[model samples]
Target chain A: MKVTLIAGSNREQASSTQLTRYMARLLEEQGFEAEVFSLYEHQLPLYGPGEAYGHEEVLKLSQAVKSAQAVVLTTPEYHSSISGVLKNALDFLNSEYFEGKPVLSASSAGGTVGVSSLGTLQGIVRNLHGLNCPEWISIGSDQRKFTDEGEPADQATELRIRKAVDTFVHLIHRMYG
Target chain B: MKVTLIAGSNREQASSTQLTRYMARLLEEQGFEAEVFSLYEHQLPLYGPGEAYGHEEVLKLSQAVKSAQAVVLTTPEYHSSISGVLKNALDFLNSEYFEGKPVLSASSAGGTVGVSSLGTLQGIVRNLHGLNCPEWISIGSDQRKFTDEGEPADQATELRIRKAVDTFVHLIHRMYG
Candidate 1:
């Protein structure tokens, strides 16, 4: 089965994207076909109600998510919530796209703790009608967590990320495999 | 004194923008120079931390908000919170831009009641160090609340908007005038 990893930031060299890459590798190691959908490549127009939903990028993104059996979402916390780029991408989709799919929420923040964005993402995922995995990954002071090559710099952080990924993968198998 | 009204959606003829226009007019009627800054006209790049803040549109938006003594922010509720476009615009700014400025929050939603986006906006404005005016305007069933010309269709809704604008203007004069 295919599991999509969405990197929720457009910034080049973002820690969130690094985490996404790491998660994708982990999922691949677990025998799943994993694809990383980076927002850096998509310059989606701002979503406007009543406007034509004809953006090629949005359509492509919608299709990718729809085809995935499960998704792992990673975002950089901005202003104590998920980044705008991630939220904007979600805005392009509706409950129909995510309904019944399992989503694993993850985030990275500059602070010592990364709890604030979890609630926001949970609320948004619920609104999208996606089943959020009970296990989540949050890396605080994220700038110090990753190396220049986008790999975890510390073993402890890497272990935490693997644990979260394992739990999400287990849930996916149990629920939909 | 200048009071900036930010229409927090990119949809052409959006009810959020209509409400913003209405609020701008009310502020003008209250003897304040009010300008409406519609997101429909801006195509800002997604914000990236640690990246060079060099976008011309972002610079222009920052300058506008900095020049204003007060601001009235209106957004459309999406996924039970403020639209991503609005949040993206805020991400481009920091506390310095909105510090000490009084902000009046408003929103429109498709549901029977519009309360979801209010808390989210309040938290963001406070994080930016802006004083959020206690009075807020929320127009629910927004599609039915406005006429073809974008004016409030009913006297009751118009009255509510005017009252909220009046309260906001009063607070602006009291706090920053």
Candidate 2:
């Protein structure tokens, strides 16, 4: 299965990207192909109503999500909500791209747990007509805290993330198989 | 009294902008000095966490909101929520500008009334520590449909909008007077 991941932060080399990369590796281990779409790396202009299909970046992201068997979207919480960059990308497409796709949501937090952003994202997924997996990954501070060895400092967060991913993978497998 | 209005749409000459302009006029009539900050005219780059202070657009908007006695935010609903452009602009600043201010939110809908976006916006204002006025302005299609002479087709919407504006101004006067 092919999965598309969205790293929904505008910071350079953000923990949101790192987290998505980690998610991709785990999906790969489970016999899935994955690609990370970094908002920081591919900056789309502010969304324009009735004009997204003409934009290059929107076309690319839309194509990736449309063809994928499942999607994983990761965001850094901003002011108790999903980052505007992520929401902006999502605003460009609608049910056409997301319909019936199993989407797993995760958040790259800023010190605290990203609970509110996850709630808002779930609502958004419902609006997009996507099948939102109930298991959420709110990257608490420990999940992104890196040690001097350049690895996440805590393994407990990893286990939590794995469980969510495994559940999402199981959900996708049930749909396609 | 100063009231800062945000026209939260990226479209050129959007109805969202027009709605804010109308609100500004109403506030001006109520003896409140009003300024409509057009997000469409002043395009902000996607927000970078902890880096907004350096950006010119952010500084301008933050200064405006900080100095204003009250605020009126208008948006176009997208995906059953506030437009990403509006939320993106908001993600740049926090309670430093909005603290203790009375914020009245309005939305210029695509076709239906933007009730969900208004609810979401109220939650965001609360997160920013602003006092959210309970009365909301959910601009229905009648509010934006223009006549041959460029006036709104339905005067009923104007009356509703005026009521909302009156309620907001009353709340502000209670605070400042």
iRMSD of all candidate structures: 16.7, 15.9
Summing lDDT over every window of 10 consecutive residues in candidate 1 chain B, give the lowest-scoring window.
B168-177
Give a tens-digit lDDT track for model 1, residues A1-177.
999888899897888888999889899989999988889987777888755378888887888898898988888888998988889888888878876566888898888767578768766775675655656788877434677766799888898888878867865675564
- Candidate 1 — which pairs collide? none
RMSD of 2: 15.8
Model 1 residue A110 CA deviation in Å:
0.8
lDDT of 2 by residue, B1-177 (tens): 899999899998788777788888888888889988999887888887676667888888888888898999999988889999999989888777876577888888877787789768866875675755646788766678755543456888878888878867865765565
lDDT at position A48, candidate 1:
84
Give TM-scores for every candidate, taking all chains together and pairing residue i with residue i.
0.50, 0.50
Q: Write the per-residue lDDT of candidate 2 for residues A13-96, one digit (tens) a residue.
A: 787778788889889999999988999988888887666667788888888898898899899999998999999999887878
Clashing pairs in 2: none
Score chain B of candidate 2 by TM-score: 0.93
Q: Candidate 1 docking: what grade? A: incorrect
